[model samples]
Target chain A: MKTTELESYLAERRQLVQEALARNLPPPDTYPPVVHQAMHYSLFAGGKRLRPILVLAAGEAVGSQPEPLLPAACAVEFIHTYSLIHDDLPAMDNDDYRRGRPTCHKVYGEAIALLAGDALLTLAFEVLSRIPATIPPERILRATRELAASAGSQGLIGGQVVDMEAEGQPVTLEKVNYIHNHKTGSLIRACLRLGGILGGAGEEQLALLTRYGEALGLAFQITDDILDITGDFSQTGKQGGVDAARGKATYPACLGVEASRQKAGELCAEAGALARALGPAAEPLELLAGFVLRRQG
Target chain B: MKTTELESYLAERRQLVQEALARNLPPPDTYPPVVHQAMHYSLFAGGKRLRPILVLAAGEAVGSQPEPLLPAACAVEFIHTYSLIHDDLPAMDNDDYRRGRPTCHKVYGEAIALLAGDALLTLAFEVLSRIPATIPPERILRATRELAASAGSQGLIGGQVVDMEAEGQPVTLEKVNYIHNHKTGSLIRACLRLGGILGGAGEEQLALLTRYGEALGLAFQITDDILDITGDFSQTGKQGGVDAARGKATYPACLGVEASRQKAGELCAEAGALARALGPAAEPLELLAGFVLRRQG
Candidate 1:
């Protein structure tokens, strides 16, 4: 697909995800409105909705319609948004801003922010279990298990633990890769797998999607690292070079900017090839790989 | 059942749950061991395993064996432990001690404790999804959704939010009841409902178990308030009168000790009657109502 075509495709998918998320979330006026408002603030903070989009695209690739897949998509986004909220807390990354606005904790205070994250995470599983009765219970169970495992201690939280420890330390290439793969890669990969499972992909198709997800996840993080160095504050939604300021381990920090860009390019190409193996319906996935490679924010 | 027989039964069930928890948790030596170790520290602390025992007794009430229900039992305990960890954070209650020892945050520092809580919560859903294939997927899914709802913004977290806001505000009895029902009662209710669902309860039986749970839960919290005012640190495992010191609302604070005791007794009696209605198999649950009412800590 051409650049304009991919842009339109992304815009359409993003809008679909936004509507589903708004519908799935409790309203801002939910009782004890502070926590609900905090949850809404972070969730609707104009994120790219990349993970949910991946869910929809992967489901589409496996012959499932978007409507059937929207709940799973929203579930993944909730998990992603919750992780971001916690990651930006005073006790965690200590960020004051995210996505061009004050972070959740900054607006709602630390305690409410923390509870809001917990609420969103709990809601994610609730959403998954509430997937329509039209889908097989076994499939929904499998999808729920996959999402939980990916978000659990051995996955996302584990990565955050290591990443926190590695800061200001002379981390090796292997350590940086582990951090990147776990911190960001696991959820991204889970998004693809969730889509495939809910979309009724066979074992072979699922395996192909998993491999594609792994490549795409790695490439996406590398691009993020490069963007932190090269992109402007307006485009990136946060101060550039903040990673370097904090002595955070990143591809560009460890391998140099030129080498990091090359690595991301190779991974995206591999991801695109894997998407091609899934045939014509995977065209969006193929384009998404390119989009990740070229995204400024 | 005689008190001695009930004591022995409780001891045996507690041991069974302890063993199950040990088997289900990742070893303390898991990679990024700090978070896992933090999880272990809070989980193995010498508190009564009230929630999981409720699960076992409730399952037994419906004539289900312990083996199949172990995972669900452990899941509830994990969620309970996680909430305690987060609740003790500096930004929350900031308690330095719990269960006669340091809180998770006090031992592991704020960041690790926070992540540890998140990890445990995620693990709960993962464990639920992995409930034995012998149980129907639909039942497991229903249980999963129920647990999440009870723990979400409208449930446990919601209660915490309101409780925090009500501190020093001269809250009414209705508001205090809302806090108790959501923060403590929701999960307690979930435990019984989960047991009933996993044990193949009919709708009518499930309804009875739920009402039994509601009464048991409220009685349990009222007793907790009484204990906090009258029990010693050595017995209750934390400082007494901390709630009043924080200007926190509780049954005793709202209605005075004599009235609080009367309230607890009435609720327990109601709960006991409901348990007895479940037939002879619910004898342990019948006994447990008395256990909650009369416990020293």
Candidate 2:
């Protein structure tokens, strides 16, 4: 596919997921509008919607239309949005901005901001539990289990715990990879695996999609690490070099910029190969892996 | 059920639930022990185990042993523990103590406390999703939906959001009711509803149990509100009159103390009626409602 075509594909899916998310969210006019508003403020804050897009793309790759996958797609985005909100709290990364907008805690006070994150995390499960009856019940159960496990201590939170503990310590490749693979990689991989599960992929297809997802996630994180060092401040939407200031472990920090870039390239190539193995239906996944490689922010 | 027998029954069930929670929790020795330790500290703190015991009693009332409901029982306690942790954050209630010990944030700092809460919330759904294959998948899915809804924006968190927003504002009975019914009542109701659900309750039984649960929760909260003003600090395990000092809206704040006590009595009576309607099978629930009415703390 042409670069412009792939870009259009991403844009279209992004819009679709955003619309679904808006529809799925509790309306802001609901009682206690502050929490809803805070949740809305962070969720609609110009996220790339990459995780939900991957969920849709992976489902499509497995011969399912994106419509049936909307709940799962939105569910992943809710989890991702909640993580970002909590990560930006004063006690966490202490960031003031995300996605070119003030962070949730920046706009809402810390108390509401904390509840906003809690609300979103619970809402993820609520969204998943309400998946339409048209999908096989078993599939919905399986997807729900996968999504919850991915977000729990053994996955996203565990990775976060390790990452937080590792900060200011001497950066080690093994430790950084553990942090990266768990923190960022688990959810990304779960997004793909969920898509495959919902699409009713066979065992071989599920394995391929998981492999593709793991590589894609690693590539995505390495790219993020590189951009934190090299991207324009406006483009990155936060102060550059903040990671270094905080002594945060990063791919470029441990391995140097040159090797980090090479690692991202190799992972992207590996992801592409896995996508290719799935044939023509995986064009979006293949192109998205490339997009991760080429993204500047 | 005799009062002595009921006391022994409550004690035995509470112990069972505690053991189950200990077994279900991820060990503190897991990597990044601080988060797990924080989670463990807050969870094992001396909660009355009322919710889990209710789950067991409700299941027994519906003719199922509590064994099959262990996961659901533990899941609710995890959620309850997480809520308390977040509620005690400096930005929230800012309470230094809970259940006679330092709050999670007080002991573990705000960041880890926040993540510990998040981890527990996520783990609740994880536990529910893994309910043993002995339970019908459909029933598990239905219970999962109920549990998620109870904890999400429209239920527990929604109630909390409004409660927090109402602090120091002029108290109104309607608003306080919304906060109490939603925040505390929702989960309490869920515990009984889940019990019926796991026990293969028919529609009528589920409805009756839900009604009983709603009344029990209201009575429980009213008793708690009254105790905040009238009970001994040593008995309540926290400062008395803290609610009034914080200007937190409570039943006694909106209703005069005499009326609030009367209301609790009425609700307890109403709950007993519902339990009685469920026949001798619901004796534990009936006696428990009476226990709530007679408790001093």
Candidate 3:
């Protein structure tokens, strides 16, 4: 895909996510005023919406539309938001800034922030369940299963456990890989799995997507670490170099900046190759892999 | 129905919950040792497994099988367990004990505790999606919809948000009700609603279940408050009276013990009446409501 084609594809996903989340929830009028406002607050706060985009892109990869996957997509964003809030808790990471705004727990108070995370997660399931009835029940079940696995101990939770455990400790490459692979990699896998499941990706297609997911997941984390060190504060939204300060087990922390950069390049190429393995169907997914590595954010 | 019949019925539902949770999770062997154990520890801790039982009973009220609703029932339990872990966190309710054992975050550390909560919440969806392919897509979607609504900002999350805000305050009756209603009640309500949806409850049956849920929920809270003051520490297992000490709102605090007891009696009766409307199928639900009130733990 040309650079121009990739940009448009990315833009299409961005629009799809924004539009879906914008109206994805029921009308605010139905809820208690305060709770409704709080829900909108964290969800609407601007971010890349990477998870939802993954859902859409994955769905499109298998010749699916954005509509069937919207609820699950919105749900992915909810889980991501919930994690940010909990991570920001006074007892946890403790930094105040996030996504160019005060963190959810910071702005909402720790208790509210905690509840917000809980609410966001619940909202995610709610969204998944509300998918269009025309979609196969089996498909909906598959998507929810992928998402649930992504969210659970074997996936994100397992990853987070290792991540926090590694803080202030010397993180071995094994530990670092476990943290990134589980914490971030699992969900990336879920995104592709969701796309594949929703899109009807066959065994071969799924196998390719799985490889793409592995490569992209690592590349995504490596890029995040690089950005933490090199990106401007205004652009990254989250506080900078704080990972090193907190002694977080970031990729750059273990590999050093130059090595991390090389690793990220290698991972991106591997991801692109995996996407290419899907032939033309995965062009957008392949282009996405490059964008994940090269994007300024 | 006679009390013996009720006991038999309750026993059957309890058995159902055990099976439901059993089939849905990863084989403990497959899990990362610690992660797997923690998930099982919280999951199997010996309570009545009341939420799943309620779900099963609710399904029975409309002829739904116990097996089909297992995923959702387990999901409800997951949400419930997540709340308990967070409630026990140092930054929140801060109890060192639960069910006569060290609390999750206590044994696992706060970080793992948080992830455990996240993992449990995520698993709820996984369980929901794991339902067999034979079940209609519409039924699965509807079941999930009920799950999400009860779990989200409009429900449990909202109640928790308010509960956090209201702690250590001079709370009014209305405020206390809101906190209690949402914190525990929303989920309890969802348990039945999901069951109803799964069981094919008609609009009328659903409405009746809603009423049953509301009464049972309030009664459940009132009983929790009463237990905090009245139950023995050895019996309850969890550290009791923390609510009163924290000046957290409670029915007894608002209504005094006698009135609270009377109110629980009234609510349980109301729940029973709603179940009675279901004829024979409602008997288990009625007994379930009574079980909520009369049990010491």
Candidate 3: Cα lDDT at B236: 90
Candidate ordering by lDDT (highest first) = 1, 2, 3
User: Which candidate leads the pack in TM-score?
Assistant: 1
Interface root-mean-square deviation, candidate 3 = 1.9
Q: Which parts of model 3 have CA positions greater than 4 angstroms off?
A: A25-39, A168-170, A279-281, B26-31, B238-241
Sort by TM-score, top down from the best = 1, 2, 3
The numbered model that scores best in DockQ is 1
TM-score of each: 0.99, 0.98, 0.92
What is the TM-score of model 1 when looking only at chain B? 0.99
Where in model 2 is the C-alpha error above 4 Å? none
For each candidate, C-alpha RMSD in Å? 0.9, 1.3, 2.7
Every candidate's lDDT: 0.93, 0.90, 0.80
DockQ of 2: 0.73
lDDT of 2: 0.90
Every candidate's chain B TM-score: 0.99, 0.98, 0.96
- The local lDDT score (0 to 100) that residue A202 gets in candidate 3 is 85
